[model samples]
Target: MSLRLNCDLGESFGSWKMGLDEAVMPHIDQANIACGFHAGDPLVMQKTLTLAKQNNVTVGAHPGYPDLVGFGRRSIKASAAEIKAMLQYQIAAMDGMAASQGLTLEYVKPHGAMYNDMMANAEVRSAIMQGIAEYHRPLVLMLQSTPQAEEHLAEAEQAGISLWFEIFADRCYDDDGKLLARTKPGAVHSKEKMLAQVKQLQEQGTVTTVSGHTLNLRADTLCVHGDNMDGVNAIQEIRELIS
Candidate 1:
């Protein structure tokens, strides 16, 4: 069995560098590049695309709400129309950069809070689907594995878009297949625990949640946060495990 590994990169803006993009690129199969909404400028985006191309990694657009201060981790209030428009704008911007480099945008993954909100918000989910569909129906939507995620996937599939189910290796989930809230005590696991969790997910198609319950999951791709303090170490361990 094989699984794809993806990482959020190109989040650095201006003088502020974020993520071990250079170090982590070699270990990942796909690179979700920030599209200037949450974090990234034109130069950073271009550089990132080039790096991905050099590394032979698939390029994807990572769009988020206009909340750079919060690193796109804060939920913002917006109507469906606004959400759709913003998404289109972000994707177009990234697509332009990718085009200049002669690299195709392979997928779209909502970043941070925008990603979490869409997991359950029908309006937001539809708006996201509409935005992606406006670009190209074949673009893959990368999403977490959950009941709500399944709903979003079905909607995207109905709209003629492909879906890529993702599982987080650095985050915790509940038995119901929902990601644990960040505010929770055990929301994120340690490096060792994370490795073990990923092993189970990769080998058994299931994860044992903090609540002591198991949930079935389909992990087409695994995600590792680039912003974590131990992000580099986590990536190294995951690569060793998957290899």
Candidate 2:
């Protein structure tokens, strides 16, 4: 079983640096880059793409609601049409950015709160897939690999898009197969625990939830956040295990 690693990159805004993208790039298989919505700007995106290219990492667009102030971690009420437009606009911008530099975006991953919303709301998921289909691009959508993923398959197929089931390498899961809130106790795992998680996912194909429930999961890629020094260290550890 090969587990591909993906990390969110190029999240720096104007003067603020969000992650050690350069350090983290070499250890991962995929890069889900911010498309100037939640975070990142034109220059930052270019720099990140250049780094990913140098490292031979597969690139994907990380689109989110336009919430620079909230980092796209806040929920925004919008219709399916609006959500579709938002995704198309962001994905196109990033895809064009990648193309200009002789790189191609092969996938899409919604960032932050939008991701959480999509997991729970069928309408939202459909809207996002609809948007990707409307873009008329052949791109894999990276989404949580919960059982409900089946619910979104029709839309994905209807939209003529593919999907890559994603699992988080460090975050704790709930009994419902959703990620635990960051504020919750035991939501984030320690280094040892994270490694144990990888082992379990490899051997048992299930993750133990924070509520002491075991969740059967399907993972095509594991999300490794590249937001800080700890995250870089985690990525290195995860990369060694997966490779």
> Which candidate ranks first by TM-score, i.e. highest?
2
User: How do the residues 37-145 of candidate 2 rate in per-residue lDDT, one tens digit apiece?
Assistant: 8999999999999999999999999999899999999999999989999898889888999999999899999998899898888889888887877786678889988
C-alpha RMSD of each candidate structure in angstroms: 1.6, 1.3
C-alpha lDDT (0 to 100) for residue 198 of candidate 1? 89
Q: How many residue pairs clash in each candidate?
A: 0, 0
Residue 190 lDDT, candidate 1, scale 0-100: 85
Candidate closest to the true structure, highest lDDT? 2
Return the TM-score for candidate 1, rounded to 2 decimals: 0.94
Residue lDDT tens for model 1, 143-220:
888756566667987777778889999788887788887899999898888999989987898888878888888778
Name the Cα RMSD for model 1: 1.6
